[model samples]
Target: MEYYISNFSNVKKEEVKIKGSKGSFIQWLVTKDHGAHYAVRRFTLEPNGVIAPHVHKYQETVIILKGSTKVCVGREVKELHENDFIFIDSGVEHAFYNGMDPLEFICIIDYVDDMSIHPVDRSCI
Candidate 1:
């Protein structure tokens, strides 16, 4: 699929769950035309919102768009502002917290078809 960069913005948006949060997110593109085998999401987080600790079989990259957030990658914790980005490797525990007002960001994850591969165990902490 040859996608003109000009026509890329024509893609539709969809809502998705941000892992452990009650909040939802909007996904702009996750197709073959986007040059990604994974999903890409653009979403906002409300004040005090949280995306709980979890790990995946595929890597994920998050780019902060607005406001501030606290990100935990394994044992490390850092405060991230706009333009900040974080890369999480597969099987590493991580989560995010919106500590300073509402936060917006883009999260990209490589798509995996097997549900057995992305085993999310909430009881593991």
Candidate 2:
């Protein structure tokens, strides 16, 4: 068996440009290169940051690691804090907005060739 080990400090963070997203950064923790079926990523959002409503083909699981966030899943909106986790079904519209402080979270998703994100109407937010 093959394995890869990583530390957050040793990983590089990249600024990801998602439509309607502001102050968002991403760190790829585990990926296909690691021979994993799913990918693990860490995301950080600056204060008042927003990741607008969008949907993807793959299901996603998010775990809040720091600070607080306002989340919208479909028509329902809720506030989540550290240690909170949520599972989003494939094609379900969702978004994330940071609170007063920066927000951090871990996102896990299935590895797929098409992970395209489709924008959802903001009226639902």
Candidate 3:
């Protein structure tokens, strides 16, 4: 078996460019190229940042690492703080918003053939 080690400091943070997204950054910790069946990503949102409502084919689990965020999943909205986590089922619409403090979290998802994300209207959330 192969082993991989990474340092968050060495990972490059890329700006999130999805339509309607603002002040969000993403860092890929593990990817398919790394021989990982699942991809692990770290996301950081600047204060008041927002990730627009969207749904994807792959499900994901999000673990809050720092600060706080308001998450809208399906028809439910909840505030999450550090150490809080949530699971989002496949095809479920979800959105994230940072509060006054910057929000940071880790997301784990399986690498799937269809990973395309479809945007959902804000009114749907």
lDDT of 3 by residue, 9-118 (tens): 99999998767889999999999888889999999999999988998989899999999988999999888999999999998999998889989999999877898888
- Between candidates 1 and 3, name the one with more favorable TM-score: 3
Local lDDT at 118 for model 2: 88
- Ordered from best to worst lDDT, the candidate numbers read 3, 2, 1
> In candidate 3, how many Å is residue 81 off?
0.9
TM-score of each: 0.71, 0.93, 0.94
- Model 2 clashing residue pairs (backbone): none
Comparing 2 with 3 on TM-score, the higher-scoring candidate is 3
Q: Candidates 1 and 2: which is better by lDDT?
A: 2
Provide the lowest-lDDT 10-residue window in model 2.
Answer: 116-125
**TM-score quality measure for candidate 2:** 0.93
Model 3, backbone clash pairs (residues 3+ apart or across chains), number: 0
Worst 10 residues of 1 by lDDT: 115-124
Displacement of the residue 55 alpha carbon in candidate 2, Å: 0.5
- Residue ranges of candidate 2 with Cα displaced over 4 Å: 123-125
Query: Each candidate: what lDDT?
Result: 0.69, 0.89, 0.90
Please give, for residues 2-115, the per-residue lDDT of candidate 1 as tens digits.
Answer: 553533356654444545664535656564566757677676767777776666677779999889888877777888899999898778877777774888898887766542
Query: Best lDDT goes to which candidate?
Result: 3
